[model samples]
Target: MAFKIFHPISFIFLIFILLAPLGHAKRSTPSDKTSSAFDFIKKLKGCHKGNHTKEIHELKAYLEKFGYLKYENKSQATDDDFDDILESAVKTYQENYHIKPSGIVDDATISQMTTSRCGNPDIANGTNFMQPHGNKHESGSSNIHTVSHYTFLPGNPKWPPTKTHLTFRFSPNYPVSSVAPVARAFHKWDLATHFTFAQVGANQNSDMIIEFHRRDHGDGSPFDGPGAVIAHAFPPTDGRFHYDGDERWSIGSVAGAYDLETVAIHEIGHLLGLGHSSVGEAIMFPSISSGQVKNLHPDDIQGIRALYGR
Candidate 1:
């Protein structure tokens, strides 16, 4: 059995879910030889997402392609937290190119990562890429790292090892009308991860931003173009997720492509503290194909449970 999880969505977003080419081509995948997921992230292209021009642009394009952000911002996170963000971003990128959003960070993601990945390691790391002396910060504008999110997300202040409830909020932009589907996704967390969500407004003590856009909107990771980058987020402390509005998000089986919900599920995993699995069957795997992402695969469940020990 597929380990069914259930819950009904309380709120929903009404937006176009899918907008990419779909066709069940005879399961022929191109060969990719990259080893680690990050190395692959560096090689994705805009069409294949194999070679993004810039890291910031590549990050945004990945978010836009997937169209969902599970984490929020303005709070805190860390390099380890980036493990989740990068894994999720990589998964999203895979979904765009009709790959699986498995969170493995395989050859497909590497093939579609930023264009800069294939060149010098320093440039790929954004160390050698320097802004011109006159390229100082302008009022109302954020740079590459601070464009849409923060690179140095100070760890969570209230890093409680446990929580009350795991609330799953639908982005205000996506067309997620069916409460059942949204709730189904949330249920997966409860059953698999075991974290319950305390209605954010039940006591009404806190609120954070969980939406997406291009350029520096105050966070850190910024969007590059319409179809290049996806979106980013701050981990648990922030719980804010931003999705670039410049791409197409779809649902259901789209031939040889991935489902939007599948990508969202993987990104949500990041928001919840889980990182990439490096295993294809794991939901944490870096990528998935069209039909493969409709449901939560084994690898995904294993990763979540391992983190929270659910």
Candidate 2:
């Protein structure tokens, strides 16, 4: 009886050993594969060497997918290991979203990563719609504004030259004090192109409508509040510009403030039918550094010119 029991027990132990590898394989799959980016980010906070590597890899892929990082060779597999490339990409992403460029995964960076954003991509190199040009830096401004790479919206759409004067109105919710900055934003674009903006009181019969909205303010493209997206504008004839009211907005150099003019210039570029550009200095770039004032880049000027001749 003892010998028979030992044989059965040994057989069960052998089966367990054979299945253990399969179980380990399942468990060894990176947590990033099974969790949301946010969950992965939560793990990255203050993570050390030999830790959170899976999350780092996931973030590198995210930035690369969104045009923040460029891979030299398409055939090369993305390294699962966290390296300098991944760290730099994280820093660049942080700056774009106005988070301090700590070069480490931080809460602010993670939050921006998880926030819902404009469907538009920050870069469009592969699309035929983009009119690629070598970057040119203009002379004599504190910051050069050149049209580096000009890309267009679907169909390369632009407002008809005949419709040179565009009318606009502030959503009742827009602070009256903010009108000056909005007008300034419009002026910056107007100087670059043939179009002009007129701010009217009525929302109807306006070429563009500007408003400050908080979560789900209708129009299907809802604001995600303060950090992720400061504002978004409709392309071409749509003429809807919305700002995330939850942002800590300021006109000038205020610590931890989102520069209103800089954001407006970007959104207005969208309203004028410009898509995001890969050029870091271009106002049309999808993200902004906090409190950093931007001037138009040649890429921006060239874009508008390509659409509507200067």
Candidate 3:
């Protein structure tokens, strides 16, 4: 998890998200042990850390840095064999993710055991989009993905590039609260070593226009009421990006709500010719937040690079 300290949210988080089908790792409630590993990991303390006699301290430190983990003191340690506990934790993670659970300390297991992750976004790199839950991010991301890639990648303009840049003509029609986060998101991309080529601004002259209203715009995508889904976009020629005004567009987790800027960044990822990444933890993987990088993940970078060749 991102934070060293565990979030005090209802343990149900395990049920709603962590336990959902994501990869091969399935964390079913163990009938033998009273509580399931989901329950156990949930109580593991977002901040507590046991000794480092082994290299597990790195995992503890990562959880601490992100502030999502609760380290348990050795005394609080489970009576289960250390190996079993580790196996169970990995299994629970795998079960929750739907990854093929070997139960052995394989690369997938170690990847989960180590990488520092964002809150609900605590998925490892190589597998984000391949998982079912990860697919949630790409529900409406096709336009941006296909369009952007067709224009900028090796395939050449499979579709005609609108010589006219419509992104500049439009202005940001979204809520004012979104302006800062939108700008922040853009700036974050601009800050990336690989984002140097991308431009920012929301007005007509800008490379892209972000809107926040509902009803069918020029493009076919319609914003559902806030919450469930907040926005969507068309590929290059569309030059139009939109947000569902109903959402509370913020930079943080919303309990059950989605983040506006995060969504915007995702849509923006679409606009830029990148496709949803199959890698589970990638920004392009279709969803991310909590422990996900506020900026583009490396695989996102790779995809964009493949499209633009930079």
Q: Output the number of the lDDT-best candidate.
A: 2
lDDT assessment of candidate 1: 0.41
lDDT of 3 by residue, 1-310 (tens): 0011112324564344344322222232213122211122332332212322333444333323222233356542422233444444444455544456654444554444333221122232222222322111244655332212111212222123333222232243323334566665665555542443234554325556766565454465444342223456555544566665443333454333345566666666666654444455556544342212355676666555555443
lDDT digits (tens) for residues 1-310 of candidate 1: 0111112212321111222112212231234121322342453333223322334333443343333233354221211233455555556445534568776545655555532111101111222111111213345665532221111112312225656455545444433332334445556666666676433432334322344455555765655533333445445656765654433333455433334456556556657754444334445444454345445666556545544554
Q: In candidate 2, residue 174 scores what lDDT? A: 53
Superposition TM-score, candidate 1 onto the true structure: 0.46
**Poorly placed runs, candidate 3 (over 4 Å):** 1-173, 193-204, 288-293
lDDT of 2 at 28: 19
Give Cα-based local distance difference scores for all models.
Answer: 0.41, 0.64, 0.41
> Could you tell me the TM-score of candidate 3?
0.43
Best by TM-score: 2
What is candidate 2's CA lDDT for residue 210? 81
Q: List residue ranges in candidate 1 displaced over 4 A.
A: 1-159, 168-181, 198-210, 255-258, 288-294
